[model samples]
Target: MNKVFLLSLYEEAVRVSKPKHCLPQYFNAFSKNDRVCVLGVGKAAADMAVEAHNYFGSNAYGLVVTRYGYENTESTGNIEVRLAAHPVPDENSVTGANALLAAASSVEPSESVIFLISGGGSSLACAPPSTVSLEQKLSLHKFLLRSGASIEEMNTVRKHVSVIKGGRLAAASKGQNTSLVISDVVGDDPAFIASGLTVQDTTTPQDAIAILDKYGFDNASPLRGYLANAPLLPKVKGDYKLVANAQSAIDAAVEMAKASGFSTRVISYTEKGEAQEVAKRHAQIALECKQQGKPILLFSGGELTVTLGDSKGEGGPNQEYLLALTKYLDGEPGICALAADTDGVDGSKDVAGGFIDESTLRNAKRKKIDVNAMLAEHNSFGFFESLESHIKVGPTRTNVNDFRVIYVS
Candidate 1:
């Protein structure tokens, strides 16, 4: 398939997984008269709340926290919409967290508390404990992001430090609580998605400390002490359901490819590890497909990490994944690939991700962009920008982790 068709398939994967399309099925299960205190958290939170409002009418009214620029004010009926810092928490994140807690706690026993949780909710729904200040939490967030911690490990620390996470939000409410989640984690475990705001948290503070120690984070004594003394979440009752995830998006993309007459195979759904390492492994798979001399589409989905350390580069994990793939392939013919965060933002950049084919590096060299230097600095965005190879889709208002496609023809 050509680049246009391949990119369209990726877009289809995202659109099919959007909150506006998938949430209504779950919303219809709840009673129409149920007073819903909706706590929408993630990039898709506001859009999810709007779907709930459309179904429940005036019964749905609560706080929603999405990434900046994603809060849809026009269609957000009854529900209160707010913006907060993502990938890192800010003062406004604390404010939004408090509002979500107050809204949940103030509900009557007969009311139904619904949490629309997704990826990025861990930072968006921030409510640090009294012992940990907002500034301290911010510092810790930055440290963990740079520490190369997995989503599970980062959330292990997040749940202990935050009051709203680790099922504490559900404990505060004496109503029927249900969490409709869009899973971005590898296993699609509800607990890791947004740190399990409404689900039961089995991990203790010691678990959080263990994760911190494993990473050798600097000056974590104060944070460790806080976790050591932190109170456990009160036993709470709630229901958690996975409405969308990486596997679902990958399946959609695979189906699209098959319909277009390409021999498609789902390589994996829960792939993980460092971005560059994963890219090298995937490039090997593509090489195998090319050697077989048949048109084939390889599909995979998972979130990959980029350890920034001190490297100040303007790119996300998906960009790094593709750039590294190009280096490994070395302009191998008949191989084309695309990698992107289904949420429409990769790492800290607005671009969804980058695209690469056999000529990607050659095109970059013509522009005098040194791919090696850019890769060394983790500056994949700069490299792709020079070649106009980055995919820009804005916010699709849904996140199901990273979507990747490799075509060998």
Candidate 2:
């Protein structure tokens, strides 16, 4: 369980967890027709659209909105690619969102809309209602992210502020809207992934309002009123399919660990909640298992939300989880862990995530790095930076939320 070994296993897990390789397999049944539109809006939409084109060739036509640098670097002659802001709304997102709505609206009822819905679409591919400006949405999104709100809560707010969320895309399609979604939120609720653009939500305006109230934004949010007793739907509903999920990545990691000469078991891909707390629990579990006990390798695929207390330092939930996990370990032996977002970006920073072995904090302590203070500030990036342990993979251009792996040998 050294750094190199831990990194090798983690990288192997990440390579297997990608949305790019997984998306194409689901499109095999899709027919290349004379009138077919393939629209995507999420962190993985760009790659999803590319795969659709690869499968359907020129038969696919439509747009995909993604975070900047998340789009396919290679030009696709068929699918239109649009880049926009993420975790927050922006003018570019609005424009791209309009394109999707327009495309859906103009399509004849006989045509089929293949909607590629993945993680991060809720913010990156969004058009706030005409009454809500991009600035308002951006401010509120940022605010919500720091308020200890869950991904579901954040998207609940997002669905109300936008014109094309919570199955509105399906409503706009008028015809068939087939959703190929990658579950990110806990429980894989279709309504929360990218704000459920093509999936129906059973949540009511009360649910949305409750989220706002929990975040202490009930009075601040302009759309709070609209969320009270609002319709229990997206105006129209469509079919949804879970293409790939956290279990896929966790299973891959477990198989690879076994092949690498270590017995492994995948805990669950649906884990969620506070990052720091998650790290502590994982560390405890690893401690309880001696190397002879199947050499536990827990993998989780769901997204984790961090409630930033007073503008916490730069680091995503994955980073925070790792740093916090270290606090519980106290330099214990034969314990190593890796936590990262499947989308390749964590927090507002560019770092994907980082690696930690039993010696990680021991090494950091020698350098006089206050791990507790840094963790308290939720500044996992700064702490990792000081230790030169930050993992940077740039945008993997796909999203399945966060992927975590822990190994004991």
TM-score of 1: 0.97
Model 1 off-target regions past 4 Å?
A: none
Per-residue CA lDDT of candidate 2, range 1-409, in tens? Answer: 6656655655665565455667777766666655578888887788777778777878788889988888686555578999998777678888999899999988788877889888888877778766666777777787788898888888877787778888887788877778888767778788888988887777666777777777677495666655563455656656678877777666766777778777665666777788887777787778778544556666666777777768548888999998988889888777788887777788888888888888888898899988889887888888888888877888876666777888776
Candidate 2: regions farther than 4 A off:
17-20, 218-221, 226-232, 291-294
Instruction: In angstroms, give how far residue 257 of model 1 lies from its true place.
Output: 1.2
Candidate 1 residue pairs that clash: none
The residue-by-residue lDDT of candidate 1 on 312-398, one tens digit each, is 897989999999998999999888999999999997879999789999978877788777888889998888888889999998889
Error of 1 at 141 (Å): 0.4
My TM-score estimates for the predictions, one after another, are 0.97, 0.94
Candidate achieving the largest TM-score: 1
Q: What TM value does model 2 have?
A: 0.94
lDDT of 2: 0.78
